[model samples]
Structure formats: C-alpha cells, structure tokens
Target chain A: MSTVLQSLSTELADAVESAGRAVVAIHARRRIPASGVHWQPGVVVATNHTINRDENITLTLPDGTTAPASLAGRDPSTDLAVLKLAGQSLPVASLRRDAPPKIGELVIALGRPGPGLTASWGVVSRADGPWRTWQGAEIDSLLRLDLAIYDGFSGGPLIDAAGRVLGINTSALARGVPVTIPIATVERIVTELLERGNIRRAYLGIGTQPVRVPESLARKLELKSDLALLIVSLESGGPADRDGLLLGDVLLELDGTAVNDASDVLAKLGGDRVGKPLAARLIRGGQVKALQLTPGERPTSRAA
Target chain B: MTASMTAGLAQEVAAAVDQLRQITVQVRTHRAATGAGILWNGGEPEGPGLVITNAHVVEGERATVELSDGTAARARLVARDLRRDLAALEFEPGRAVVGAVVRDSPPLRVGELVIALGHPGGLTGAATLGIIHRAESDREGRTPRWIRADVRLAPGFSGGPLADATGRLVGVNTMMQGGLALAIPAVAVEAWVRRSQTMAVS
Candidate 1:
C-alpha cells in the first residue's frame, strides 16, 4: 500500500509538470474576440481560422514558434471547429462534470495570452443554462466567472484546482467580467463530436414568437399559462409544415409537456428528438389540436 | 461645324446658357451641393419643364426646385435609374423655357473637341475646354455611350450640358476622372428624360 501511494504521487506530479510545460500558446490572425463582455482572464480564446476560412491564417505556438494550421472543420450553424496541430504530446485538458457547480466554488483559468502562460483566479459567478453573450448570441450553458477578462483571453481553458477544465473561456461580462462554457456541456459536446462529427441538433423549421398574454386576454382565452408561442413562419417541406402546423397557430405543448418559453421547446428538441415522433399540441382559433410529427434530418450546410 | 459657323455658335451657346438659367436650379443636399438644368416644355418647347440631372445629384429628397436667378419652385421627382445614374424631375405649369438640341449621335471620335459648362464648386458660370480622350460604347453595361475627356468638371458641375465644338448638346457632364472630365451621352439622358416625361403625363 505504501509503495502504491508513492507511485501514484510521483505520477500525479509528473503529469502536472508535463502539462504545465506542454500547454502552448496559440495565435491566429484576423480572428478577434467578438466583444469585451465575453473576455476571460489569464487566457485568450481565439478562432483558429477566420470566420470565412478563405483568408490566410497565422498560428503561433509557445516559445515563439509560429506555423500555419489548416482549418480542420467548422459547422456554420454551430460556429465551432477543430483546428489541427502538428505537435506531439499536446497537453489535453480534462473536462468538468456535466453537473452544475455549487455556487461560490473557486475556479481558475490557464491560458497562453500574448507571449506567456497567464493564470486568472475567480469563483463560479453564475451557472445558468441559457444567457446571451454581448453579440446577441445565447450561450446555451453559461458559467460566468468573476474575473477581469481582457482581449486575447478567449479560447483559453477555465480550470479548477484539480486541473480539470471547467469550461472554455469564451467572453467577458458586459461590465468587463469573464464568462465561460460549462464543462458538463463541453463534455456532452465532445462525446457528440466523437460519435458524430458535429453537434447533432433536431429542427422543426418553424419560427416562434413569444406571446405575452395580457391578464384580461388570458382570462378571456381561459389559458393555463400566460405564455404562448405564436407560430410565425413555417419552412416549406419542413416537418412542422408536413405535420399540419400552420402560421398564426399558437403552440401549447410538446410530447405532453407544457412549453412556457422558447428555450423549453428547443431544449426538448435537442439530440433526443432526432428521427423521433413527437406529439405537438397547438391552439388554432381557440381550438386545441394535436399532431404527430417525426423529425427529419437537419439540413446539412457543409461540404463534409 | 467650322469656326466661322461657331463664331455665332459661342453667342448662341451663351444664349442657350441664358435660357437654361431659368431652369438651371440650385439643389442643396445634406452631404453635397449641385445644380440641375431643366428642359422646359416638350419637343415643341410649350409644355411643363423637366429637370435633368445626374442621378447622384438629387438622391433621397422630396422634389423641390431653386432657380439660378433665385426663384424657388415646387417640383416632383419623376424617375431615377442607378444603372445610368440619371434622374428626371417634373414641375407644375410654367412659362416658355429654353431646351438644348441633342446631338444625333455620340461624339465623332477621340480628340473630337467638346466644351463642358456648369457651376464648378457652385460658381455661377464655369467652362472648360478639352478634346475627347476616349469614346467607349458602354459603361458597366448600362449607358452604351460615354466620353472620357481631359476637361475637369468639379463637384457642382454634375448635370451640366456637354456641348460639341458646334455648340450642340452632346452629353450630360457626369463625373471627373482624377480631376479630369467624363460625361454621359446626351442621347441616353434625353431618352431617360423622355421616358420619365411619358410616365409623368400618363
């Protein structure tokens, strides 16, 4: 038992030592952080390729070694990609668990900002499933970190004391605090990427608008909740349209679950709904109607 | 025409410029200032006047006219096509006004003499002389005729008439090339003015 403990201690120390030295700084040109609010401390996260990959890209490694890295793959819809690097024994950061972290827990970040390895320490500011970034993009799993995040800290790793990656440092707070992607979400994304090349999302191809029913209108309509989803536009030949969903219809529920917000419908439509028949309830002209819809394959907008 | 014929041609050109003074209106826009000349009346020279200008001169404004002699008149923007960057304006009932004689065709050839007339930089009457450098059949596939010249037309000279050596209106001075000169063919601009008039009448 004493021998095993000694061996484990030595291995852990070696792993830390190797990882600290192996984490290299990456820099690509014309790939700038979107806004200040999403800035993360100590590390700069950057897109390895330009928003449009046709432009030239420059990647710099730690120790001032710069080279060109080919654009691995990017999903236009998701705006995520894997940039291929040529080096060996790259220090891979471990992902955090999918569960939300307890509030007030300490979080740290390690990033290759500019020319050196930078570290930022903060606490888990907020753990919300959905919060919008400064650019009007809704971050699905947002873990706000309490740190003054500057530019060049994007695409860096937000980690914990155990060296587990809590999330990918994405942006800064509107008031200049840093924000990150929750580890649980990143882990699921990694799993999905390993099994499938991209984030496999299910779509119904229907535009929805939030209906904030007035108190009098809700009483007059005799609704359970004041919230309703007004179907705005239905894509031609989409599953929703084929299932008899029409414009001006107000959606009530999906698969026996009431939907009070647009995110609720989206959350239910995540990977599980792929090729699955769903029960959608709608109120058209104050008459409730249910339709059976089997989701179709999401439109592929990529070369591969 | 020969210089002997043009001996009176300059006087006639000055007279034409004098007649155009009634229709030569000052247009003030948010970003720039320009002048436009109206060909009052129809082919018979006895109908409501029509304002002619480079389309860029009067963009995005409710039509209103200001005469060079300083009388403001209410006008209506008739038609605008960006391809040619030319626009027309229609006005209410007005008295007899002078109109130019359109050249039967584009300029004869490169080095053919031409005179540009307008208010360069808002100066009342400015004229520059230069020979046509190149006569192209088409510009961006819209107007199939354009003349590139060395005569300089300043910012305020757009929509001013470009007359041949014989003093016949041949083009509507449009843009300057590196402080040089360029004009849209008068026949094409007249066609737009005519088409716009027909639409306004109907």
Candidate 2:
C-alpha cells in the first residue's frame, strides 16, 4: 500500500539525486576534501575557510573524474570563495531565489566529501533579516539550520525538498554554528569576486569600543546620545591617523548618524564608501570637534 | 494539508515502529552494558528462533534475550564472525516469534527516510528517524562494507535494526563513525546466516 511516509522518503531521495550532481569534492586542503557547488558554467563556489591553500586545487566531479580548478578569489568577510573550472560539463545548481526559506521548512544538506555524496536532513530553525559577520560582511539573510553537520559540510549547499539550492553552508561564520549564505548574497559575491578577484571593503583603520559618557561630560558637551565609542587603537599611518584623528578621541557621530557601536561605523563603510569623505563628530580635548575623514580601501588580510 | 494527512503520516510511522519493535529484543550478557538484537528466522520455516546481534555485545557463549513482551530466554551462541562483527544466537521458540523482514532488492537511495530501533541509555524500544547518508555503490555482486546513516545512535543501540520507511530491515546498527551511524547491511547478514547454518549442518 502506498503511504504518505513512503512518498516523502522517495521524493527526498529524488531531490538528493538531482541536487547532488552539482556538488563536487574540493581537494584544496590536506586530509579529507571539502565540498563545492557548480554554481554557474565554469564557476564553482566553496567556503573560504576550507580552502587552506590558494593554488594547487583540484576537484572530483560527479562522474568520478578529477579536474584542476583555479581559485578565482576569496572573501574572508563572507566566508566564501569562488573557483574557475575550465571545460567542465557538470550541471549547475538549481537555485531558488524567488522566496526565502521559512522557519520549520524541511531542508537537506548535501556534501561530496569523497567520491560518494552524503546527505543530512532537518528543518530550518531560524530565519531572520540581514546580519553582519564579525568580519564586517553583511549576509543577505540569517539562515540557521537544525541539522547535524559533518566533514566537508562547510562548503556544501543547503537544499530544499525539491533539490533547489537555498544557500551555501558554512561553519566558519557565526562561531561554528552552521549558517547558510543565501543565494542573493552568493550571487553578489560571485559576480564581484569573478570581476575584481577580491572583495573591496572600506575601512577607517581605527578600533573603537562603546563607552558611556558621564552625565556631567554629556551636559557640558551638549551631546545628543549618552553613549559614544572610545577610540582604543589606531593603525599607524592609516586612514584615521592620517586624517588627524587622535587615539583618545570620543567619537559621537559619523555622516550625521550616531556612532554608538563599532557596527554603526561599519554600516557606513561599504565598498562604495571607500574614496568618499565622511563627516565625523568627536569630543577632542573636551570640545566637540568636526572633521572630514575619507575612508581608504582596506587591504587584503587587514582587519579594521 | 488536512489534519488527517498529517495524522496519516504519523500513524504510518507509528505503525512501522510498532512492527520493528516486535522483531527487536534486548540482549544482555554478564557485562554491565546492555545492547539490542533482532529476531531472525534461522532459514527454517518452523525452527528455533534465532537472534542476531553484534559480536561485541555478546562476549560469552551464552547471553540472555528479552522479547518485546518482557519474556526472557537463555540463548546459545550459534555463529560468530568477529571480522564482520555479527553473531547469531539460537533460542527455543516457546511462543510465536516475529522475524525481521529484510529488504531484498532495489538498494537504498540517498536521503530516503529510515528508522532505527534500539535501547539507548537503557531505554527500551526507542526509535530515531534519519536519512541514508549515502547509498551503496551500484557495483554488481559487491556490498558496501557499511551502510552509513544520519541517525543518532548511542552505545546501547548496537546490534539493533535499521529499517527503511516501510519497516523492512536494511542493516544492523553496529557502530558510529564521524557522528554517522554505520550499519552492517542486512543482505550481508542474510548471506552470513546461510553460510553459517550450512557449516553447522555439515
């Protein structure tokens, strides 16, 4: 007798069979290989953290053939890396971009750690709006899963019951919690990485920590917000240092927006903001001083 | 979807678990650790009931088998292959026994729903649901060494039954590796039982 349970099982297996064709084993690191998806024609996407070395990368296709793949670029902020595969006929992942995954929706994670394709199933646990990573990259959406993660899971794809790609899975982001980098974000990064060979981010090169201004100081300075960021460290000869900003300055606003936290400063430091001058308001020598600081393009491997 | 559809799926799963529980038995040796076993037919239409468990779970020549109805029986070790980590126990069938129905053909597919019945943490007849992590290779006449699954299995779950969605036995839950449950495929177990029974008759 046909039952709903059997149908569910068969459909799930069919989904895996279809989606798994795009999943390939990436042999970039030592020991067990990681996973990568055939995102587009001649383009593969994987996790940045899993690619230990920049060169000498190879891939195991679904047909058990080994092919050399060149690393196009990597963005540590988003934990994503794009690789260029030449003359390969692998199928591209079918992406679901019209709608975001809902909470409690059944999802499967597919990985090709070895020649065999592995799968794990679970429900989407949490789905929220865009969030920023510690590296300052803003993910399109926060997709937390309730599934068990395994080896090579970092660079795999989180697929739905229909076998359509939802996002790229990564354990490096969110402090070891499995998070999916949505299709929108992946598409944006893949395009930029393929073009520029790296992600361009704006940086002030100054470290700040949130601090509470004393009520007496706040009243004297006529400050609008009681909380301000205290400049703790400055990169020598960096943008902030070159802009005449001191180490002990209390930053109150940037571009007329209140700067209460470090992320607030990051919110204004996108790639488009790199060569533009920003208005900064800070309390220097116990006096409100205004300065125009132009952010610089953050060099690769440098933290703000 | 109506409430009845959801309930129908739930009922189907519950019924599959019920069928699996009847074929599952608790295996206890002189050791402190307890494991589970599956009742087998011993290749005879009406012969003494046979229990299949892990060789690691049954160390001595004799171990105690407890049926689903809480009836205990003394069983003698009939066949053991340490390399395969499988052992067969023969016990008198004081009453009718339900043997596991093994799936014969059309090997497992990746992502198919599977159910595992075990006695984890001293809990009897506990069931956990998962999907087949990877299907066996399609090579003819060759069975994969282990059937890896995504199910969570504890120490007490060894020698239990890993059934498909329809409750047909697929593998014997043996050990866990890399957080994935590895099972001995039932087809291999059936072959071993046949060969072992032949050696006993010879």
Candidate 3:
C-alpha cells in the first residue's frame, strides 16, 4: 500500500510541475482572465472567445513574470487563436500522439491563472466526436470534460494523468459549456489563421432567425429538429439572392445536416464550404423545397 | 473510444466507489437547495445520527436526507458554524449508518491520491478523482484554513466529503481558494462536531 501511494504521488507531482511550466495566464480587454499553452517556442495558443481585443495583450508566464504578447491570428469558428511573444522560450507541453484518451481515464486541466498554478481534475465525460458544432465547422474530435473550467481555465490544456496535453479546453464557443478543441483541429486552425488573418466562412447572404417548425411540416419532411431558420433579410446579389431564395422561407436543412436554428446554418458556412454548391432544403408555402445554391464568402465586417 | 481500464487501477477505483456508495446520501432543503451529505453517528448509534455538510448548503431548519436506497427523512438542523462553513443535521436512525473515519490530514502530502463524492449539478452519487495540491493557510491565518486539492467540484458539490484513496473522508469540499478547489480539513470538522455535541449535552 505504501509503495502504491508513493508511486501515485510521484506521478501526479511530476505531471503538475512539468505541465505548469507551459501554462500561462492571458489578459485581454477589461482584464478578462484566461489561460494559454506555450505550444511552440514563444508561441502561445489560447481561446478566441475570451479574447475581446487583439491589441495590448499581456501574458503571465510560469516564472511569475509578465510579458507583452501580440495577437498573431484567431479563428472563431474553432474558438482558437495564436499569440507571439518576444519573451524567453518556455518548455512546450508534451502532447500524447498515442491512441486517443479513453472515456473514463483521469485527466487534469491546469493553468496559471494567477501567480501560481491552479489545477482541476476529473474524468473525460465524453470523447466521441467527428461531429460539427452549430457553426457547422468541422471538429476533428469532441471531448467533453467533467472538470470545471473556472475563471482562468478557459484556454488551458486538458492533459492526461501523465501531463500530456490532449486538447485546448474552451467554453467560449460552446456558450460557457466546457468542450475541448483537440490538437489536430488546433494545429489546422492556427496555421490557417496565421496565414489568412481569419478563417474563411461560406455565407448564403440571408439574415435569419430561429422559429419553431410547424408540427405538420416537421412530420411531413421527417425533420429531426423542431426548430428552423426563417429568412428575415438577404444581402442583395449574394448567393441566396442569386438563387431566387424567397424571404419567407424557413431553412430545414443545409447539405443534409438538419438546420435547427440560425446557428445551424451558420455552422456549415465555414470557409471550406465557400464556393461549393450546397443543397438547401427549406419550407416555402408549407411545402418542402430543395434548391441548389453555391455558398459565397462570408462578410468580414463584424468586430472581433 | 478505447478502454484504458487497466486491471489494477480500475479494480481499486471500483472497490473504493462501492465502499463510498454505502455512506453517501443526498440532502435537500427548501426552494430546491440540494447537495450531498454523509451519514455519521451524532454521539451514539442508539441516538439520532447527523448528516454533515457545508454551512452554506443549509437549505432550512428542517432538511430532507435521501439515503442510498432512496429512503428519505427530514433531518433537524442541529448545529451550524458559518465561519467554518460546517453544518450538522440530526435525524432518526434508519437501519445502520456508518460514519466516515476522517484521517488526521497532516500526513497527507501534495499529489497524494484522493477521491470526492458529491451531487454536482443535481446529479447524485457522482465521484471524481484527483490529488492533493498541498495544504496552506489563508493570508490572515484565521479560521477555515484549507488543504487545496485537484478534485473538481461544482455548485451542488459544496458540503460534501473529499475522501482519501481508501475512501476515508479527509476533508469537506468547500469552495475554490487561490485558484484551486478548497476543502476544510477533517480535523476542523471533527472539532466542530465535538463542540456541538458538548453544547447539546450541557
């Protein structure tokens, strides 16, 4: 018993010590607190939602010192962003390249939200995903954590018991619900954001609102979700306008994924789908209609 | 997608969860205030036992305790210390209630294995595991000094037990302090219970 306890103690202590070195606190506008990982030398990856402004970014490193960081790029579709610092190089977190973590294994979310490191431990609540968020952006994997993502943990790493970072935990895009943006997705988004300033998203050029699908129509179309998107307006000369999409149509499905709300349509509008012809199924005049329309590039006028 | 349930650690955790399930129960107060509490002997088994929880989780003067087997009875709020965030509820003895043997807590070092049982987010009988981060005194060195641990606790987890790897209750899961999950040492809770018992007898 003594031996078992001692071995476990050593493992956990080492995990915390090594992982803490890479966790840094990020402060954006209004002093909104967050955590980030030193994935690459002098490159910190954090969540985009907690970061309201790109200018005047500051980071608190593990050595108990602060440094000014510059925003390199950010992609809100995946809720990930990158920052560059001219400060000293920190040891990058070791990421496990082995099999994906099991559902019930021990995992810890660590961050230096303040002067010292703060840790939260729990099991992987759920790890099954090749699914898409409501924004319709592709997520390589979805990892739901039972651990609490407290004030400074939004961008922290959810590492295994061995201290290998599994993913960047963020609740920003998930509406405060903890979801891990996996390493594969993080690398892809960071590369694109660094090159393009923002990830391109396809748009149908229609402002829509969520409304309940009439029960009669739902049963007729065999739709899974009871809600649909009702077109309120359109960007003149945009994809929907060019396709003669009416203003009163309620979107039921886009590219086979059921559109439950405005977010559902927006989710599938990510840059990868831009310029591709997509099948939009809508209910016009109480009848399900299918239309072929090529998605246009999403406007970049919204403030970050 | 794959099972990491190796034979050794999986067996140990399963056994501990089984032992913990026997003593854990749900505490309910008015206006839907709910949390987890542990059953313990108030003084003697023949006398009514008490359900221990956090003072901030005190739902009302008369709180309902639901046992593991789903039996419930209203427990009287016998004593409460808000300063320590500890509360003890005396209720009728049903069957036999086993109290958790809390360790001295000092011998526990940083990174020692620990498990927590609580009703977090309204879900009862939930258990999560972590390690002790290290115990430290607050700035003022006043009451409610804590041994912070890595075990995660949500809103409904307040007033529950942070047990050792062997399932012995070592601390009461309180709130977060200094960015870590904080718990009141079991010695503090035991001392509070002793004072409450002495006061009742006097």
lDDT (C-alpha) at residue B121 in model 1: 71
Of 1 and 3, the candidate ranking higher by DockQ: 3
lDDT of 1 by residue, B10-114 (tens): 565566455445445655555345665545344566666677777887777445666665655666667888888887776653665556777765434433445
Kindly report which residue stretches of model 1 are placed more than 4 angstroms away from their true locations once superposed: A1-22, A31-58, A67-72, A75-80, A94-102, A128-142, A161-164, A172-177, A212-223, A300-304, B1-202
lDDT of 2 by residue, B1-202 (tens): 4678779988899888888999999999884547999999844537698999999999999988998889888999999999999999999868877799899888899999999999988899999999999878656569989999999999888999999988889999999998899999999999999999999999
In model 3 chain B, where is the ten-residue run with the lowest total lDDT? B135-144
Residues A1-304 of candidate 3 have per-residue lDDT tens digits of 4334346556776787788889898988475478999988878899887788879998888877899999988766677889988858789988886778779878877766666676767789888967676555788887888776656677888888788999899886567777888888888887887788777878888888889987887898887888888899988899999998989888888898887667677667777788898898888988879998789887664334
What lDDT is reached at residue A56 by model 2?
95
Winner by DockQ: 2
Model 2: which docking level applies? medium
Report the alpha-carbon TM-score of model 2 versus the true structure: 0.97
Q: What docking tier does model 1 reach?
A: incorrect
* TM-score ranking, best first: 2, 3, 1
Model 1 chain A is weakest, by summed lDDT over 10 consecutive residues, at: A33-42
Which residues of candidate 3, in runs, are more than 4 Å off? A29-32, A207-232, A249-270, A273-292, A301-304, B1-112, B115-129, B133-145, B152-181, B184-202
Cα RMSD to the true fold for all candidates: 25.1, 1.7, 8.7
- lDDT value, residue A222 of candidate 1: 75
Query: Mind giving the per-residue lDDT tens digits that candidate 1 earns over A73-179?
Result: 44433234444445433345555565556566655554554443444445787776676433222356757776534344556666554555566665433444566
Residue A296 in candidate 1, Cα distance off native in Å: 3.0
Q: Show how many residue pairs clash in every candidate, following the order shown.
A: 17, 0, 5
